[model samples]
Target: MTEVFDAIVMYQRDHKEKDLMVKMLTRQAGKRMFYVRYGKSKRYQFAAEMQPLSMSTFEGVINTTGLSFINDVKATRPTSFLMTDIVLNAYMTYIMGLIDAAFVDNQPITKWYDLVAEAVTKMEKGLDPQGIANYFEVQLLPVFGIQPTWGQCVICGRRDLPLDFSEKLNGTLCQQHWDTDPYRMHIDNRAVRILSKLAEIDLHLLGSLNLQDKTKQEMARLMDKLYDDQVGIHLRAKSFIQQLTGWQNRMINRQSSAKEDES
Candidate 1:
């Protein structure tokens, strides 16, 4: 049966010599695969709408156990920036990969669908992609069977003290209990606060990230360690994001040195 639904185009690949296989996360039908034929037909004409990270409305047959087919399509959101910006594309790829990792195929998760749709829309509107991605990563932890204690200290259950993240403790450590874990990550307190905020943030209401560079760096380190220790899944897209960040940092350093030399 043909059904109408909104979806995010996750990724696509060549199916055969003359067709493409498109994978989309549909709001109503979950993740479904559709075949976009390469011919002068309406399906082929709308094939461009299947670009990665783009949101579109689809009229298609959604099957539970096999490949579905697309009948018609139209863009549901403005994603010109996602198509043109390489960095945004990288973030998009990583975000899509993350969703795939967190859930299985053909599983209808409307809440997660809404969250991911809002996140991509935010990114297209020029919000910080890394910040949005970070929020998603934190939210996905529970799906990986990790429930970090971000609300209160794991040991003393205190909420009034400054907190530090302890991978060994698998949660936050209050100032009074910091000595309990010798390996507690002594990151910027701001990082811990941001993680707490991210844990409860609504993606629909989240604003632009206004974090200090040091705080962002510290948060990244802490999150990386946390994921490595607890959730061991790795995606190549994440490594690409790291490489992009490395290049950005190096370019910033080069420009700073050039300015200092001129001064």
Candidate 2:
């Protein structure tokens, strides 16, 4: 029997037999892989619908082994820009890719799906991609049961001062426990306040914080470390983002040096 599901594409890849394996977070069925016939030749492939970050209705037949064969796809949202625009393309890649790395198959992903959908729409509305990515990381980490304890010390029941963030302990540490772990990431009050605000804010309304670059870097570093130490699913897109950031920094430095030489 064939079934239809409203879904958002999370990750996609080429199959060995000239087909496509599209991993989607669906409204009804959670995460699913839909294998499309003739997905490579473009004669039958719905490129827009098959692209990652697209919300589309997927009509497919599920096999006994839980795999699905996509019969058709109809785009439910305008997602062509996700492929065409370079910046949006990269943002969607990381956003949906993180979701892909976070959840298991066929689980109840309705909330996560809505979160991804909303994030995509927010990006389209001109939200800061880096901040949005950080927001997604902070939100998704909790879903995987690996969030950092923000307000108080993980030891001695102290809430007066949160001094350090320990990825190994998965929470904040006070001065007493600060040097206890050599691997603890230092957490000043400012960074703690920033992370606390990140943890508490509504994702939909989080685009205009005016955070400093250092704060943003700290948030991203802590989130990535938490995902690595606890969640254990390595996100592939994150590496690419880092590379892009490094390249941009090098270009900026080169331009700065040129200006200094001229002066």
Q: Against the true structure, whose TM-score is highest?
A: 1
The lDDT of each candidate is 0.84, 0.75
Per-prediction TM-score: 0.94, 0.82
Query: By lDDT, who's the top model here?
Result: 1
Off by over 4 Å in 2: 16-18, 62-64, 143-145, 153-163, 173-183, 187-189, 207-209
RMSD of 1: 1.9
**Tell me, what's the RMSD of every candidate?**
1.9, 3.1
Q: How many backbone clashes does candidate 2 have?
A: 0
Error of 1 at 206 (Å): 1.6
The sequence of per-residue lDDT tens digits that candidate 2 reaches over residues 25-119 is 88777787877767776676587677777788778775545677777775478877677876677767888777767777877778877777787
Tell me the tens digit of each residue's lDDT in model 1 across 5-57.
89988888886677888888889877888877772345467756877887888
